[model samples]
Target: MKVPVRKQPSWFQVLLILPGVAALVVTFLFPLLWLARTSIQPTTGHTLSLHAYARLFEDSFYWWVIGRTIFIGLLCVVITVPMAFPVALFLARSQSRWRGTLTALAIAPLLTSTVIRTYGWMVILGRHGLINTTLVWAGILAQPTRLDNGPFATVVALVEILLPYGIISILSHLSRLDTELEQAASLLGARRLQVFWRVLLPLSVPGLMTASLLVFVLAISSLVTPQLMGGGRVFVLATEIFNQTTIALDWPFAGALSITLLGFFGIFVALYQRILQRVESQS
Candidate 1:
């Protein structure tokens, strides 16, 4: 049997796509081009130079910042996946009437502005805030301890902020899975733990990887949470870029930093795609 020939798009079809294409070009492509152009330009002259990039590379402090950023991203992934997995699994498998409400609650964090959520965390983690107040009242501490403006606060806030993305990624995959394989494992004398470890977990690797990638990328690129929670102490790439552009008035260096951040994203994306491909081939 001959396969049906695909039809070419009509003028009307092309017309409908024009506005979206134009918007993408205006919003994303043009800005990206501008950023690339700015990254190479000299601070004073319009002449192109790699001075900013060289400066970034030669500085040990910037290298430390890069490493710290990567560490934070990895840390967020490590914390988020374990916490999100159980929630995603429950949401995927539960037969309860409140499943909808539970899922909604899981994603409800996204509805609020990130700045608002970060401030909420500030209230909870501040020196005289809820945690310290309770600890002091209970005689657990002699005085209220400082919690905010540190790595601990930044990590905690980031984990909470990125948790929803992890849940959504894992849940989408889990919900699409064939349940029969899990049942079959159980029938073959496998215990619940054995079934999960041997069967369900292996199948869910793709979803876990996706969640990890999403959380890591977001964590590294995050500025506000780290800025507020870090209280100018935490220096991630995003915050540093903000400082370079706004405070330092080093537009070219800021552009270089932005480019470097994009490089990190590109490298991780390539690595993840390769790993995902290998996993898919094996499965």
Candidate 2:
């Protein structure tokens, strides 16, 4: 029998990818192109200039905000990753009834609006809020402290908001993994912790890294959490972008800032992809 060559993909198959292609063009590509154009253009008129980028780089305040944004994003990821790991592990390994309840509770926050969630944090972290009131009742502190308007509180809110993503991502990986290897490791003299650290965690690194990337990107782009929790005391790149576009009425500057933010996010994603590819190669 002669082997036949496979046919090329039909037009329909090619067209099937159009919606995603169109969405990418409209949502991501167009904005990115516009931002690049605007960045080099003059602020007052349409004259081409690199003044915006030059001025942006020269300003210490802008640099500080960028640094703060990165710091907050990293802090949120660090806080969420450890907490989410156990929750994800539980969800992946637990019996049906408990798993269902825990999964729902973990994902319920994902369905809520960002504004509403930030407001909830506002209440919880307010000077006279539940935490402070409870602390006072317990006599842990002499007075209620201002936690809502600080970097720490902003990070806390971001952690809460992004925690579910980390759990869900890692949960999928953990759930899909075959337990036979782990069982064999345990049977052979490996402790439970050793099996987890060597077999389970190494296998789950891809998912964990993906979750961290998602959380970091979201945290970097977040506005409401920082705005509400920081109370104008702390400024992040996203909030600064909003202010530049709306309050300052400087689209060019805003676009430049957006381009810079996009550049940073792109660098992060590229680095993650490189690491992932290296891991895959090694494996």
Candidate 3:
């Protein structure tokens, strides 16, 4: 009787996936577990307790920072999305020559370091900087307006940094779409706007949601732009985390803040994924 032997799975497949799995576990999973553990620990003796979370709710300052962070994030998204749409459409639909050039230009800000970009904005919005000088020279204002180190300046810098993300995301979606579907819609007596609204918009929901969520998460977690632009006035969740960890030397509080922020952004991401999945199934 001849016995049949079962073939072993290839070692190459296991080798290929091992690095990614290891990286995920080491970088994200371990840190998240540590944060969760620390968040519940007592501040006094480093034992597990809910005191940090209770304290977070009791402290009005935490709530204030949370609300301000949300407000700024929404403002950034509102400004970035509409502005990026046309730019994304241009990059997606335009000829390769111009589209390539424009895409590079659009992402130029992202290529620059965040610190460098914020410094550039600082110059532009400073009292004695380009914007103020131009405004005064052109008689737009008699004196330099205090725009730097304010909510508006933070929003402006955040929007500039995150705008490229929205453009790139929507551009990827638009480029992947079938043009024939759009042509068919046009053939059915639809105008450019009509075709865009009826066909393009609905299909692009996943991408739009993705881009919005990206901007929202990035805006909320960001510290550098707010720190540089806030000038000690505006404080966000990330800044609070920084303060807790460094200035206050309160790791438990910082961990709680991290967990809270993670939960906040996690909800949005979950919602976005749910809606995106449903839309994908229907489409």
Candidate 4:
């Protein structure tokens, strides 16, 4: 009897994964490693130290900024999710010819640069701007109430940017929903609201959670919209990092801030994954 030889894996298939692996190593892993190294390097002392981290903890202001970032992210997601669901559900259920156009309209904001969008928001919500002008024209306000450079302005702009993500996430889930189950619920004498609550909502937990996580991550890390819309009043981790890196010429402090923000999101992601896995297994 002859000894059989096992066939080796194909090189072409292996080549396909190599590019992606290399990109992750180059873009993500190396940057993270560099940041960690820089974070440990003290500015004053030649040696590596944790002085930056200690200073961050010693300053309560940094903690407040962290809270603000999270709060703004939460606020944006909370407002966007409910609003996005109806639009997403409509997109999924509608058979109208104009549905494509409507969907495009919903997603159009994302096509433009974020800075341009923020500037557009400034014009619309500014003191002497469109909203004020229109309201003044309508005799609604005696003076143009300034929402320019405020959190409300930032939230509004962020909502416009973030809503598409939420809508798309929910729409994807809605499209894959089992219509037979919905029909069964309908046949069981469940009204529209009852059918939605008892069927669609339960099925959509995964999508909603995913959307929330994505929106939160994006909103928290975003720099331009907050910078322009916040008008320097909103001092977030990103802006703080910008200041430390560019303005103060402090790389170590910036690295510490970067790692701190990264760690928070990393913990958030880990917890999210664990919870998601549990929910999926239970389901």
**Ranking under TM-score, best-scoring first?**
1, 2, 4, 3
Model 2, position 183, has a per-residue lDDT of 88
User: How much lDDT does each candidate structure score?
Assistant: 0.97, 0.90, 0.89, 0.90
Best by lDDT: 1
Estimate the overall C-alpha local distance difference test score of candidate 1: 0.97
Clashing residue pairs found in predicted model 4: none
Clashes of each: 0, 0, 0, 0
> In candidate 2, what are the lDDT values of residues 72-148, reduced to their tens digit?
88888888888898889889888777778889899889999989998999999899999999999999999998788
* lDDT by residue (tens digit), candidate 1, 1-283: 9999899989999999999999999999999999999999987877899999999999999999999999999999999999999999999999999999999999999999999999999999999899999999999999998999899999999999999999999999999999999999999999999999999999999999999999999999999999999999999999999999999999999999999999999999999999999999999
Worst 10 residues of 2 by lDDT: 38-47
Per-residue lDDT of model 4, residues 40-118, tens digit only: 9977768999988998989999999989998998898899888898999899889999999998888887898999988
What does the lDDT read for residue 214 in candidate 3? 88
TM-score of 1: 0.95
TM-score of each: 0.95, 0.94, 0.91, 0.93
Off by over 4 Å in 2: 1-8
For model 4, state the Cα shift of residue 109 in Å: 1.9
Worst 10-residue lDDT window for candidate 1 reads: 38-47
Q: Evaluate residue 25 in candidate 3 and report its C-alpha lDDT on the 0 to 100 scale.
A: 100
Residue 139 of model 2, lDDT score:
95
